[model samples]
Target: MRRRLERHLPRALERLAHCIDQVRMWQPGQFNYLNSSQYCLYLYFLSNTIWREERGDEAVGAATRLFLLNKALNGIDLFYEIEMPEVFFIGHSVGIVLAKATYGNYLVLYQNCTVGKNHGVAPVLGDGVILYPNSAIIGRCRIGDNTTVSQGTGVINRDTPGDCMVFAGTAGALVLKPATHSLVADFFRV
Candidate 1:
C-alpha cells in the first residue's frame, strides 16, 4: 500500500496536511484524528494514491481497515480515475463512494452519499461542494462551485450553476436555490 501511495507521495502528504490543518489535529503516526470524518479525509488521500485507475481496486481493498475503523465509510472505493483536490471534511462514511472517474475540490460528503455515474458518465463537481446524506449525483452533470446538494435529493444529467443549493420537492424534483445566506455560507472556517 505504501508503495502504491508513493506514486503520488507529495500530493498525498499535502492532502494529509490540509486535513490536519482543517481538522486541527496534529498526531503523527497516530490514529487520533478527532472523529470518523477526519479519518475519512485521510483515507481519501490513500485511495487516490494510485498509478492507474484499474489498479485502484487492489489498493482500496488494502485500505479497507482504515474505512472499517471509521465505521461510517462502508468501504471507500475511490476510483483512481476520479481526481479531486484537497477535501476538507466528511460527515460520515456510510455508503459513501466516488464510484467513477470524477473531479472536484474541497469536497464534503455525508453518510449514504454517492457521487457516481450512470451509463459510465461521471459527474464533475466544483470547489467547496457538499453532498449531504442520502443525496446521490449521477450521470454527466456539472456541479458548480460552492453548491450544496441538499439531503434526499438525487441529481441526474443536469448542470447546476455555481453558488447554488439544490433541494428536492414533493414530486421528487430538484429546486435550485441561490447559495448566499444559506447554511452553506458559513459551513466551514477551515
Candidate 2:
C-alpha cells in the first residue's frame, strides 16, 4: 500500500489541488494533506488513476486496497471505477454512497447522500447539482443543471428540470421550482 500510494500520490495531489482550490472555504493555492476530506479525495484519485493507468491483476488488487482504505477511513463508498467529475466537493465524507453514474462538474454531496442506480441503469446529472444530506437520486433520471435535491428528498426514477430547487411533495412526489439564488456558488468559486 505504501509503495502504491507513493507512486500514485503525485497525480492524486494534483487532482485534489485542482478540486479544493475552487471551493470558497479552502484557501486558494493550498492543499492540506492532513485534512480528512482532502485525504479522502486523494485516495479516490489514487485508486482511480491506478485503475485507469495500470494493467493486469496487480493493478486491480492495488486499486482495491486503496478503495478499501478510503472506505475504512472516510466512511465513503466511492468505487475506484466510478467516474467522478474533475471538479466536485464532498461536504462530509461519511455515509456517502456514489454508484456508477454520469456525474457533472461542480457537484456537491453532503453526508448520507446517495447517487445510485436502478436495475443497472444509473442516473445522469447535469452541472452544478447539489445533493443535500439524506437525499438520493436513484434509477433512470436526468437531473438538470444548478438543481438542488433538498435534504431528505428522494428522487426515485424521476427527472428534474434545470435551474430549480427540488423538494419532497406529498406521497413521495418531487416538487421542482425555479431557483432564485445560486446555491452552488456558496461552496464553489466557479
Candidate 3:
C-alpha cells in the first residue's frame, strides 16, 4: 500500500505545482513567493505530513486533508470540518474560502467562491457539487448531489434537492433547475 501510494506522489506534486503556477501567472504582481516553486512544494510537504499524521497511505487523500486544513486555519470563510473519502478539488485560486465542513467526493470549486459559515450553521455538500466562480453558499444548508451553483450566486438558508441546477444574481431571486447530467458523471468528467 505504501509503495503504491509513493508511486502517485510525484503526480500529486505536479498537480500542486501546476495550481501554484496558474495562480502566480493569473495575478503576477499580487501573489509573491520567495521562490515560485516553493509554494507548491510546501503544499506537497503538507500533504505528506498530514497523511503520516493520519496514518493514511494514499498521497491524494493526504493532499485533500492538507488542502482542507490550510483553508480552515487560514481564516477562510468555510464552516464545517467533517470527514470525507477520496476528495478532489480543482481550480483553486486566491480568495477561495471553504467552510469547515464535510463534503462528499468530487467537489470542484472555482475562483472567488465562498463556502461560508453563518453562526453555527454549516453547509453539507453532497457528491458531485460544482461551485462556479464568485458563488457563495452560506448557512446551514444541504446541497443535494449533482448540483451546480452558477457564478455569482448566493444561497442562504436553503436546501437544494438532488440533481438540481441553482443560479443566483445580485438582486433577483435564486433559481433552481433540474440537472442535465448525473451527479457521478459531474465528478468524473474532466
Ranking by lDDT: 2, 1, 3
- Choose 1 or 3, whichever is better by TM-score: 1
Off by more than 4 A, model 1 = 1-11, 23-34, 50-74, 182-190
Model 3, 1-190: lDDT tens per residue?
Answer: 4554466556545544443433323332232344423342344344644454444545446557656665554423332223432444445455677666667766767778888779978898897888888898899889998788988888887889979889874476778899877644533433
Error of 1 at 30 (Å): 9.7
Q: Report the candidate with higher lDDT, 1 versus 3.
A: 1
**Tens-digit lDDT track for model 2 on 26-77?**
8877878788888888889989988887755888999998899999999999
Sequence-dependent TM-score of model 2: 0.96
Which 10 consecutive residues of model 2 have the lowest summed lDDT?
1-10
For model 1, what is the error of residue 121's alpha carbon versus the real structure, in angstroms, after optimal superposition? 0.9
Ranking by TM-score: 2, 1, 3
lDDT (C-alpha, whole model) for all candidates? 0.67, 0.91, 0.61
Evaluated with TM-score, which candidate comes out highest?
A: 2
Kindly give the stretch of ten consecutive residues in candidate 3 with the minimal lDDT sum: 76-85
TM-score of each: 0.73, 0.96, 0.60
**Between 1 and 2, whose TM-score is larger?**
2
- What's the true lDDT of residue 62 in model 1? 51
Clashing pairs in 3: 78-98, 78-99, 78-100, 79-99, 79-100, 80-100, 80-101, 81-100, 81-101
